[model samples]
Target: MVSTQLDAHEGSGQNSESEKPTHVETEHAAVTYQEKNAFQAHADESGEGQNTKMTKRRFMALVSQAFLWTGSQIPVYLFGGVPPYIYADIGGHDRWTWFVLANLLSLAAVCPFVGSLSDMFGRRYVALSGASFIVLGMIVCSTAHTMNVFIGGMVLAGVGAGINELTALAATSEMAPTAQRGKYVSILIFTIVPFCPSVLWAQLIAAHSTWRYIGLFCALWAFVGLVLTALFYFPPPRVNSEGLTRGEILKRIDFVGGFLSISGMILFMAGLQWGGYMYSWKSAHVLVPLILGAALVVLFVIWEGFFAPYPMFPRRINQAPRILTLTLIITFISGANFFSILMFWPTQAFNVYGHDPVQVGIRGIPVGFSIMAGACIVLWLLSVFRGANRSLMVISSILMTAGCGAMSVARPDNMSTLWGILVLAGLGIGGIVVPASIITTIICPDDLIATIAALTLSIRVIGGSIGYTIYYNVLVAKFTSAAIHYIGGAMVKYGNITSTEVIGEVIGLTSISLLDEIAEVPGIAGNEALYKIVIQAGQIAYAEAYKWVYYVSIAFGAVSVLASLFLGDIASYITFPKYQHDSQEFERWRGVRMSCEHSLAEIITENN
Candidate 1:
């Protein structure tokens, strides 16, 4: 019979093979055994488990979770492409950054807490609550009349998104065997295939109907998810919370840690978002929050590491500290790289490539397809190579780095090559994201999967926030200087308009939102030749600015590559013991199984 014990390193951080347990007695393992016996008894009574097919109820549960996952992703994919229309309708040209920042900050802030709550309370209600929040937030967003009100709605939706995202990942991961966890997660992600064109959908909707309808549609989708979750998606009770009373459970929650983590993330990201955009980096408005938030975050880490009884990041993760730490680092850099593309690709398409909304959306389709394809490729590679995670990650990071570096060559003349470049980058993103997450679950104890997953996601978002700020500042600074030089010089040479004040006014109106208004400028009006020259100069200036962004991005990609190189081996963790039971017992146990073809107990069963 195959060994039923996990590696000693996974259990007690021991290097001695003799120290490993004969039948791992971890809480999660115990729970799996109990679940196995229960499933077996049920299957015996029903004469089921005759084949290796998933049950209808379990399939529906997976489908329901998929819907929730798609709903959560809508805001992420939609907002990036539709923000221009949102700003136009809501009149928040000056405060537009807040629209994106609000959602991101809230989503990042609540993730750790959501993981804790899901682990402590159970998955069903927490997930349902998230769907409900999405519904309410979308309704508010759809009906909002002002930017502030809309931002408020986004804050609500962001919280729900965080909760739902973590819950779905944890729920789905638990249902699959360790050996095939990555594959199952990839399948879950496949549910978003319909929304791959979400960027285009947002643009098309704005052109045909109202931007508010986007909110209405999201709300409707979330409502369906909420109903499905309410009807299905039930899993077994959490072992951690089985015997705890209501009051006891409340006492067990680390409210102090939650407060510190949430507030620290919000303030830190808020400060970053505002710095150099709304306020100077040195201003007290930015420094105060940045300093205070950093201190609080440090304190929260200390609390979780030393004081909290039920820490969000459990100590078990320390067993494979090197792998865990490296995985998170890779995850962080990947987020930075991914968001850089998501936020700026459209800008490049509009200003440099000179595409209309529809065309821009169509161009973005390659990115979505490439990301999904990359993820699928990684899953297949993992299975074929039996989880050569470190090698795969290094390769993916290299692909991403090459793709990002290649983007420096993007120009209006070579628009054809941009599609292939984007596909390469998208594939890297898909490869890195799913595997980094799966690795986290592999190294840690099964019970802490939700917490670890949440922490990984939170880190990624934080990295993205910082990356976005850096790229934005770089683009603005470079673009402003380049635009003045190119557009101003062209106006003087071509248009023979040399008045500095008039030049300044014309250039100021050259922003993407106000680009058309440049034709209406006092000196430039009725001067078609001058207008064409200025437009060309502006496009060249945008290309220059975007090139600098991609160049800086290469440095980040290099960091990801270095981090991936140091990731410790996770091969042993991915292997599972074969089921040693007779065919009759296996048939009886299979009927009630919900997760996948094999239950955790069956995967690790030892012959008596």
Candidate 2:
């Protein structure tokens, strides 16, 4: 049934006698023709054709890929929690945001190209290259003496992360049956369970030892994954590149589209990251790149839709347009929500709830555990309730919305309430990415899986970039205003500090980095009572500012919930054997394994 639907779509333009096809359809049909011929040619050349079967070698490869994914994620989760220590050591307090931006910008910008290259080349070499970058970046970062050097290292690491993330996901999905894609992907996620406390690890290492060791730790682990990948992962050559010469393959790449997409994403995200934080929203620094980048993005889409011979986002996947589009939307919103928590939860813990680094790290564990649990639950549920994609997404989104919305009431005094809300939100985060990737790979053609998967990952990062910008601006603006009001009022009323200039100077020191300096502000010096009042007021102001950020997040969560509602049913697509030959081969492998187990049981019975 799945094959028939695909065949019908593929043949629509050629067989339709009643009406002429539109230009878009006609172009897609031509591309489809070339893809089919290339696949056939590759199959012919490979000769020893059997469906995708799980051998010991292949199983080991999957395990290696999972480790690579975990290694890549370590740096990402690690960096968010230790920026304070990094900045203190490197002296880039004012430019600290660049630490994250550098990694994210490079990751988002390079993802699509990585996908295209993986498809043009093969997964093994491309993935190995990515692992190499991670090692090199980690070395640079661990030894960095300046902020510029550290940021550069982050850029290299981001590029490596993009490649490893996309390739691992695509490679894993392609290896599994469609019916079990969710299960296999979930298993891959399970590898990260032990490492989910990476933020805690960062805190502990930074507190007890040098923070630079965190980079060394990640570098060492990534090196292990790199060596494993080189030894184990050997995917079949891509269908598109099987018959092409090096020059021909290079020429086939859409350089124009790649340039437009990469440049546009970098410029657009740079503008968003810089606005209101580094410069005013209306300033040319923000507006010029934002507008120009948006225009280029639009142009890139237009070029992909109409002009590019080999587009990064191939038109063939449009057969399931509604499902594809909605999944991307949910993935985007989920990313935004996830990053908001990952980036800010530690801040909230340290500022409002926890007293020390260890307490803050302990507080963060529940959310990480919940996220992994949520993902594992959804993946298992997907297997049991086949084609429950829409239902699962809806539930996940609602959970996220409820948790994020309720978090607005969190206060410095209510530690228990905060933990519960964090768990709720974390579960929602886990349910999104794996399921979305499964649905997307299910709908897309086998050859284009990497391309579509890369797009989803890229969109998620882009969403994070946008979400971070909005939340950052909101939090900073609200915190600054509330701090002036609360702290200044306390200084004047309780401390009896009347001079506006003196109050202003003291209030300015109420920032996260400068909070300790408040007592050193001449008039406040040696006055322990005034210091306590000022600190109390600042905490109250922080609580109030954070509430707005959570409230704003509720809207994004709600958007995801609404989007999930429109996803088309994918029950038949996943359950029905799409690749007949592969299904037959898998069944044979299952029988052999069962027979081997039975024979072993009989031998044990005879011995008894």
TM-score of each: 0.84, 0.81
lDDT of 1 by residue, 13-36 (tens): 322223311111122212232223
lDDT on C-alpha atoms for all candidate structures: 0.71, 0.70
lDDT of 2: 0.70
Expressed as tens digits, the lDDT of each residue in 1-608 for candidate 2 is 23433344345633322222222112110122222221222121112242345677668778878877877777868877877778768867656666676787778777767644654566678888888898899999999988889989988998898777766665665555433444565577567777667668888998899899999998998888888888877656544434455566567667898789878877887787778877999999999999999999999999999999877677887768888899999988987887778888877776666446788788878877887677667766765686898999999999888887788887778887777888898888878766776677567754454456567677777787778778877888888888789888898898788888887776555554455677788778999998888888878888888999999998999899999999998876644353445876445434332222221111110000
Q: Residue 419 of candidate 2: its Cα lDDT?
A: 77
Rate residue 9 of model 1 by lDDT.
23
Off by over 4 Å in 1: 1-62, 115-122, 169-186, 232-242, 499-502, 575-608
Sequence-dependent TM-score of model 1: 0.84
Please name the candidate that would achieve the greatest TM-score relative to the true structure. 1
